[model samples]
Target: MAGPVTAAVLVIGDEILSGRTKDRNIGYIAEYLTAIGVDVREVRVVPDIEEEIVAAVNALRVRYSYVFTTGGIGPTHDDITADSVAKAFGVAIDVDPRARAMLLEYIKPEDLNEARLRMARIPAGAELVPNPVSRAPGFWIGNVIVMAGVPTIMQAMLDQVAPKLQTGVRMLSETVRADAREGDVGGPLGAIAQVNPEVSIGSYPFMADDGRPNTNLVVRGRDPAKVAAAVAQVRAMVEGLRKPG
Candidate 1:
């Protein structure tokens, strides 16, 4: 697009903050968005509080191209994401007929209790993001997309929402095994990085299978030519530094 298509993830849940439930959506969302050319710039977790959710949503929506929220739209008192999102956008929220209809696919009319009805609340002027795992629909309002906290449900929502988002150029990456300790290559790597400012260079240290310290140097950039050039420089540097057994 005009610039990089960036996104922020707002994870809302008391269980996540309390550690009772481990979060599994952030990484998945980040990787998925990256593959689709949307850079995930930030991630924030908030307890099930109205003010915190509102503030996070408002701030992130303005700062990034898209905001994806996970959790707090369930059938309980603590599930307040829909209402908080409505307040953030200063819009009215009510049980949307379309959402109710979707829920009906799973829940019989008599079984759709008051608590379950909470799942149908959607902000005005918002579009629904369907959950293939569960019938409860998430929503997209302005630049924010609210989704279920459950990993499977959230993933389904993202797939439904992906085709509609504005995307940017995909990043290209190259990895070279240094077969040497990270410390051994830091200087040369830093020098390469300084000259190739267009590409990002990173070193990941690991223990080689032969019981020696080693590093993997990664070069990444949106431009293929820049990434290739940086990779060539890194390969030459590593070759010159190779140690004899």
Candidate 2:
């Protein structure tokens, strides 16, 4: 059986680090990859520095099955993800005819200034990830997939890349609402987790209608039977706790 298909997300840009541009990519990508059987194992945010981007790309590309980078692919002086990624891979980068042509669809030939041409500069031996929303395309080289920072554009690029990726077994999950505090179930939950080594048990705390503390026990595992079994145990534990003394 194939092992898990894991990935890391690298969010690059000074704006994000400075808190000027709030990131909306990481959570969306994580959920999207999870639904498609690709486990996002790690996430890192770095400023728009070439060395930072290069180091992060190299580190994550080797540690995980794939590394998806967002931001810094725009047509500006600060946008350096393409060059940084190329430097990490030790590849020569230049204006890609394919990317240029795609941009020409939206930008006129005469209007393709040096700044706009930056969007067309793709690393050698990289496949273009089509952008349906905007003409500027993202690229996929080796295990690194470079995308735009804009949530809508990044989402479109991911959709184009999804069909070609290798997926692993989909995770199954079951949630049990425990009308009790998370602290109340901590000991029992720990014991349950220790017993079901294959399943992941997590307790999320929330308030009921009356504003009393409560918890939602979520059981997740690749195997449906195992997840269901864990859920049953959690339900029984919660029920036992609720019994009148």
Highest-TM-score candidate: 2
Query: What are the per-residue Cα lDDT tens digits for candidate 2 across 91-208?
Result: 9999999999999999988999999999999999999999999889999999999999999999999999999999999877788999999999999999999999999999999989
Candidate 1 weakest ten by summed lDDT: 236-245
In model 2, the clashing pairs are: none
Give the Cα lDDT of each candidate: 0.95, 0.95
Error of 2 at 112 (Å): 0.8
Tell me how many residue pairs clash in candidate 1. 0
Runs of candidate 1 exceeding 4 Å displacement:
none
Q: Superposing every Cα of model 2 onto the true structure, what RMSD results?
A: 1.0
By summed lDDT, which 10 consecutive residues of candidate 2 come out lowest? 170-179
Error of 1 at 37 (Å): 0.7
How well does candidate 1 score on lDDT at residue 243?
54
